[model samples]
Target: MRTNLDFSPLFRSSIGFDRMLNALEAASRAETIDTWPPYDIAKTGENDYRIVMAVAGLSQDELAITQEQNMLIVAGQKANSDDVEYLHRGIAGRSFQRRFELADHVKVVGAGLVNGLLTIDLKREIPEEMKPRQIEIRTGQGMPKAETKQIEAKKQAA
Candidate 1:
């Protein structure tokens, strides 16, 4: 059973949160969740993250990773061979694509494939202007004095 949530109340009073609200609505509308090729997401540090995926029987050349804006896409294509016939096929060798939504300022630093496990590293780098800054407060004594100029009247009775 699927339940739909109404966000009309939030939309009326909120501002500049359309993207986050839209993401929530889309997630709720998804019918089936894909669980193939198990993966794990871990937080290595304050701004560092790692994603490990079990892509058995897939080589580096068969896998592709892409970063577009705030989305991370991972796709795998398995090459099929007809020369060998197997009576029992227990292993999965199929093409699959997965997408992950990334937050602002989050970027993928590196990726590697070893022993059928794909590892991807990510880091969140905030711009200097966007980071929190401290403001200095000054009292009246520290304020600069305003300059005043005196005007002389010209003698016209010569």
Candidate 2:
């Protein structure tokens, strides 16, 4: 079951928040989806993150990891184990696929599997042009008014 949410009320007051609203809507809709192969997302550093998933009974070959733009996908399909018979199967050997939405400039740095756990490392690499930079405010005493005006004019022309 799904419910329709009227976002018009929220949209009327917010400016330049369309992307954020869309992201929120997507997350709300995903709540009804499956959560197989439990996973945890954690922040390790200032701009670093890690996603750990419990994927027992799966090898590196059985799992696949892919990233398309801002989406990260991890899938696993267990091989045929019909040869081994078990009276009662407790461990889950089923296949599952998980997706994660990464923020801008966030990238998957590496991935590894150890002790039935899959760990994926991520880092947000903001470009130099995008990173916050401090502007050096110039004081009038440093230069004469004429030079400052000429510099301003040159900058305007450029």
Candidate 3:
């Protein structure tokens, strides 16, 4: 006997979960989205990681880093004046949004801007019990039956 897995009818069912379905639909749409703001992710040490974003011309006052709902969102806006005239504006001093996928254990420690590089450090401190350990075993076997009695006898004998 053979069973046929028919998923076609399941797709036709109208559960009417429009919002949830829409959000999931948008998830697929997000797969094609990519923003080019060069960045470097480096693991400096055990449980320590750093994210360096190249945000030239963006001051510390202009940048904001926040964690919301498991997303590390780095957003910044260049301080501007509408009345300023630019004879030759080549450098990009515009707004930017950068998103990072953070693991469950990973967390943002702090952030700083140095030499046009915005560095955000993350750490994942696992508990002591969570760390791997070797289990030490003692098995002189059932206490070596005869040997056990001999030691007790020796203590008494002495």
Candidate 4:
């Protein structure tokens, strides 16, 4: 498929974070990768996500999980059986690799193998200082210095 991307005006517009833009571009070009080894991405909470990939017949020793830059790669290599002759090999246990893009401030909590399913947990954390704070617009200069000073003194005393 041959197609043209028109971005003549994008260069003139204000672009932020070239890495983020590059990630978006890469995501656009990347398909679902593959449907095999089906997986599920579920939202556990408001800021938490869990990825469950059905990698049956794969042991924890045969699989590895690691994060590189902003990408998380889950790969596995099944120890090939040299002596076994299969009359009917239905399950193709060769090897597979899966990649996922981790958003900003997102960190992988941990991963575990449960019933042949690899469950990876990720969470986004926003620090109290980084969280949005509402500023109260004082109509006058501000609260009485005496009261503010008293409050500060009380906090220090505590």
Number of the candidate with higher lDDT, 2 or 4: 2
Question: Model 3 clash pairs?
Answer: none
Model 3: which ten-residue window has the lowest total lDDT?
A: 1-10
Q: State the lDDT at 57 in candidate 4.
A: 94
Q: Cα-based RMSD of the predictions, in order?
A: 4.8, 6.6, 12.5, 10.0
Q: Highest TM-score: which candidate?
A: 1
lDDT of 3 by residue, 23-72 (tens): 44555556355454689999999889999999999889999999975579
TM-score of 2: 0.80
Error of 1 at 110 (Å): 0.5
Instruction: List candidate 3 segments past 4 Å from native.
Output: 1-33, 140-158
Residues 1-158, candidate 1, lDDT per residue (tens digit)? Answer: 67899887889999988778888998999888999889999999999999999999999999999999999999999999989999999999999999998999999999999999999999999999999999998999998999998899887995
TM-score of each candidate? 0.88, 0.80, 0.63, 0.78
In angstroms, give how far residue 32 of model 3 lies from its true place.
4.1
For model 1, the stretches where C-alpha displacement exceeds 4 angstroms are: 145-158
Quote the positional error of residue 77 for candidate 4 in Å.
0.8
State the displacement of the C-alpha of residue 10, model 1, in Å, after optimal TM-score superposition. 1.6
Estimate, for each residue in 1-158, the C-alpha lDDT of model 2 and write its tens digit.
Answer: 67867676778999987777888877766666687899999999999999999998899999999999989999999998678989998989898889888888999999999999999999999999998999888888885566434344344553
Best by lDDT: 1
What is candidate 4's lDDT per residue for 1-158, written digit by digit as tens? 73545443564574765666666566666655678789999999999999999999999999999988678999999998789998999986979988888887788999999998999999998778999999988866766665444344344553
